[model samples]
Structure formats: structure tokens, C-alpha cells
Target: MRQLLKFELYKIYRQKSIYILFGVLMLIISLGLYMDRESEQANYLVYKQWEGEITADKLAYLDKEIIEIEKKMESGIETPQERLLYGISESFAYQLGNAHKHEKRIADLTAIINTDSTSYKERAAELEKNMLSKINMSKFYYDAGPAQIIDMIYTFGFVITAFLIIIGIAPILSNEYSSGMDQFLLSSKYGRSKAITSKIIASVIFTLSVITGWVALNTAVSVYTYGFHGWKAPLQSMFQHYFAPYPITLGEAYPIMISMHLLAALGFTLIVICVSAICKRGLLSLLVSGFIFGVPFAIDVVFEDLENIVWLNKLLKLSIYQCMKVKEQFVDFSTYNVFGFPVLYPVVTVLLSVITAIIFSYLTKWIMKRKQVTI
Candidate 1:
């Protein structure tokens, strides 16, 4: 078994497709890092610059700074520093206003969760309870760097996983027949269970390695380039403003979101291998995976109104694209009930991945067992 596993791994890693996948993933990491840097400079650099010594107690600090700039303008002249400050006054004001608005939202949500816990029906009540668990209800300092960038990188990182898995693992079963190796493979003494098991194991390792390397490289490079200053900050401080109610910080959300994506990739790999086993054609498997993964975004673009259909929307949201989007997991207006308990979207995504992986694994095993030496 160990020898067979090593042989399978050797074959997968020896393939030129693996190197191509790595090159593409590294390219994405480079591009995403560059974009995050540019985005930070354009969007949040001003807010971060003006956030000096500001806090909940110093909520009026930005207002005072604005006043100082206004008083300087009263002199009917401006220096370069004053001109810069004046130009950025509205943006600075907006960040301050956003901070105050965030505090208000936290307070309101906390009150509703505590006082009105029982005022709703099944899903809503479950959602409230779930939200309550996440609400820390404490005043937090504003952090204006990296949160938005990290969110963008985490999501964009999904593309690497999905694309690379297709290229690397789509041939797990398909190429055996394509190269006329299926007959010799299945008729061997260790053919039946051992061959299928080794293939499955090989695909699992390859998919996980690609996902991990992509995430680790993306996060490491981005954080190193941008500096990890915002990990301790509240999620609400993010540009999305959608995840504000969740009590998790960027630090907590980062791993959880990445885990969801990794599990999603696993689920995708399993299904693709199953398709490969059935069709025994790598290119066809790639197309099928592409269609399955791409369908959600296509729906979102082509039929925006279809999301309004409750069951259909919930079903669509389970796809790898929807599940990979951490922002939508929290902010999107969808709730799923599991065993009568309302599970958060991200949690639901992970659970669905696990379920899908299990079911597909069984189906793949059955298919392989029933597979004849058809070359």
C-alpha cells in the first residue's frame, strides 16, 4: 500500500501540469499582493494616517482635527500639509462616522439578541442566537489597514485552488483509460481496492497541498508586504461593513474562512475524481468541474433575480464559488437550518463540503469496484 501510494504521488508530482499549476498560483499571489498595496494606498491610507491616538474615548479626535484644518483654512492660505489634510477631510470624517455607526450597530444587535431572543420563529430565532454567540459587545479601537486587503486576498485565493485542482486531479481516473493503462491496472493482483484507494489518496494529498501552499503563500506574502497590523482589529472595521456584527476579529476569521475554502476544494476534488472515473476522460472531467463551479457566478450575473427564489438560492449558495466568499457568508441574506438549528453560512459550507466528500467517496469506491477492465 505504501509503495503504491508513493508511486501514485510520484506520477502526480512528475506531471508537468503540477508545475504549471504552481506557476499560475504564484502569479495570482503576486498580482493580488500588488493590488492590495495599491488599493490600500488609494482607499485607506488617509484613514490610517489620521487615526493617530484615536479610540472610542477619543471619538471626537477626528472632529477636532477637522476643526483644526478648518481654522487653518480661515487664514485664507494653505501649506502643502494643510492642503493635503483639507483634501482628505471628508474621507477622514467618513471613517470616523463609520466607526460611530459601527458602535451603534453592535449595541443595537446586542440588545435585540439579549432582550428579543424569543420574539421570532425558527430560522430567525436560531440566527439571532448564533449572532449573539459572535457578538462581543465591547468597544473596539479602529484599525484601518490590511483587513480589507486580507479579505480580498482570501477570496481571490480560491481561484488558484479551483483551477489548479482541475488541472492536477482531473486526470486521476480519466488518464488511466486514455493511456490504455486501465486494463493492466485493474487486472493486476492489487488492482481492485488498492488501486482505487491509492488514486483517491493521491488526489487528496495533491489537492490539499495545492490549497495549503496557495493560501500560505498568499497570506504570507500579502501580510509581509502590507504588515499584519489589523489582525487584532474588529471585523466590522473592514471595508465590506457587512461582517461588522460578527464578533470575530480578522485573525479568527482568516483561518476559519480559509478552512471553509480548503474543505470546499476537497469536496470539488472528490466529485471531479468521480466524474473522471465514470467518463475516463480528463478533458471531459475538467469541463464538468468547470461547469459545476462556474454555474453559481453565471447565475449571479445572468439571472440576478433567480437568487430571490428561496430554495433555489440556498442551493446555489452551496457551490464552491459562493462558499469561498467569506463576505457573502456573513452578509448575504440567507440562512440555512440544520437539524432545526440555524447554522451560519460559513459553517453550513464546511458541513456541506464534509457531507459531499463522504458521499462522493463512497460513490467513487463503488464505481471503481464495479469497473471492469475496459480499455
Candidate 2:
């Protein structure tokens, strides 16, 4: 077993495919970091300028709006919850209008300073504060915090890792047939069991190494750019509320979310490798694997709004998204209630995928033993 494992590791090291995958992962991380850096710096500058302008005058104006909202609630025209909802709605609406006004105000201030203003520094400071206030308002509605940004960066990085894993393992079994080496490997004394096991171990090691590398690279870059203080934020909630109708903060759920992501990626890689082994043709394996993964996604997209149709809704709900237990974490929605219990889509998906992969691996070995190698 040790000898077999060593041979498998050596084979992986000799293969150029592993290097190619590593290069791609590095490229993706570099580009993503560069883009994020520019965006975050600009946002930070705006924030700094706004901090200087938060004064008594601005507070008084904001207090007037709050007073009006309270007065409406005290009139007994609506329930407290209803009044609170209305107030929140009104606040968002006002923010939208304020954004437009703020832009125009900045433009006018710039023109005045350029033409006749001797108080250029003071005017610039005020305008910067105004811009920053707009940024803060926007942040409330959308995820602009360091944690959210890191999450997004990590997601993209993971996607790159997935692509590499799929490509790396696509030829695991197929290349043996293509190069007429299958017979030699299978006919040896300990061939059938040992060779197959070695290949599996190699594929697993390669997949795990790639995942770890990409995650580490992304984490390092994120920390350098955004700091490392927001690690406790609930990853699941943050992802679910990414584009949700009602945004929520899951600041306390980050660890579970990260674990789920890692599990999903590992499960997905194993399934793809199993498919590659079963198909024994790189192109066909890739296509079949892609279809198996994509068909469920396409079904969800087409029938997502048919929840009113009981059977269709149930079928859609049972998709790999729900099966994986990370669907809620990865998808945006107003609310999620599944059979009176919260759906753990990521966990379920990982479990199901792993089971399926194991079954496929056994089937592949069984089929290989019975078939004649003709290359």
C-alpha cells in the first residue's frame, strides 16, 4: 500500500496537468485581488471624508425625520410592527432620492470651488463628507463590509479551484486507455485493486491540495486588503441575503458556513473524478459530468417560480441545491422555510454527492474487472 501510494504521488507530480491547474488558480486570485483593491480603496477614501462632516446640524435634520415617523405611529392609525415596517421602507426610499441629490450637490460644490471659492479646503471636506454619507447609506442596503467582500473573493476563488479539479481529474482513467497503458496496469499481480486504489488516492490528494492552495491564497490576499477582524460573520446568512428582498446579518455563523463550503467542494470533486473513471474518455467524461451537475441547476432556474404547483415545487425543492444543504447559503431569497425546518442544503448536497461518488467508484472497479482492455 505504501509503495502504491508513493507511485501514485509520483505520477501526479510528473503530470503537467497539476502544474497547469496551479497556474490557473494563481492567475485568477491575482486578477480578483487587483480589482478588489481599487474598489475598496476608493470606498475607504469616501468613508474617511464623510466622518469629518457628521455634526450637530446633520443630527438635528435626521431627528426631524425620526420625530415625524414616531408621530405617525402614535396616532393609532397602524400597529407598531406595521409602523416600523413603513418607517424602514420610507428610509430606503429617502435614501434613493438622497443619492441623486448628493451627486448633484457634489458637482455644484466642485464648480463653485473651481470658480470663486477661497474656502476650498472646507468646501472639499464638506463634499467629501456628503459623498461618504451616501456610501454609508448604500452599505446598509448592500454588503460592502470587509467580511462580505472577503466572502465574495473566496467564492470566486473556489470556483476557479473547482474548474481546475474537474480538468485535472478528467483524464485520470481516460489517459490510460488513450495511451494503451490500461492493460499493463490491470494485468499486474496486484493490478486490479491496487492500481485502482492508487489512482483514487492520487486524485483525492490532488483535489485536496488544489483546494487548500486556492483557499490559502485567497485568505492571504483578503487579509492584506480588508483586515481579518470580521471572521465571525455568519457566512450562510451573508450569502443567502446577498441579493435578498430583506437583507439579514449572520455575523455569528461564519465557521459553519466555511465548513459547508469546503465539504461541498470536496464532494463535488470526488463525484467528478468518479464520473471521469466511469466514462474512460476525457471529453465524454467532462460532458457527462457537466450535464449531471448542470441539469439540476437548469431545472431550478426554469421552475423556480412554480412553487404554487405542489408537485413541481416539491420536485424543484428536492434538487441538488436542496440536497447539498448549502443552497440557502449560496442563493438569495426573502425567506426560507422548508417543511417547518430550516433547509440545510449544503450539508445534504455534500452527503448525497459523496454517497453517489462512492457508488460510482465501486461500479467503475467492477466494470473494469469484467471488461477486456482493447486500446
Task: Indicate which candidate wins on TM-score.
Answer: 1
* Candidate 1, superposed: residue stretches over 4 Å from native: 35-57, 67-123, 126-149, 152-154, 241-244, 304-306, 309-311, 332-334
TM-score of every candidate relative to the true structure: 0.80, 0.59
Expressed as tens digits, the lDDT of each residue in 1-375 for candidate 2 is: 778778777866677876886787688657856546665554445333323233455456546656666777788666544454454445444544444555565676566656754454444434443433333224222223445444542445445555666677767777777777778767857778778878777777877687677667766776566555433322322433333221223343444455555555556666776676677677888787667556665666687567677786656554433343343434532123344433334444556556755776676677667767555
Q: Residue 245, candidate 1: how far off, in angstroms?
A: 3.1
Global Cα lDDT for candidate 2: 0.56
Worst 10 residues of 2 by lDDT: 239-248
Q: All candidates' lDDT scores?
A: 0.68, 0.56
Instruction: List, residue by residue over 176-276, the lDDT tens digit for candidate 1.
Output: 88998888777878867898888889989998898777667766766655556656665655667443446677777777777777787788888888888
Model 1 pairs in collision: none
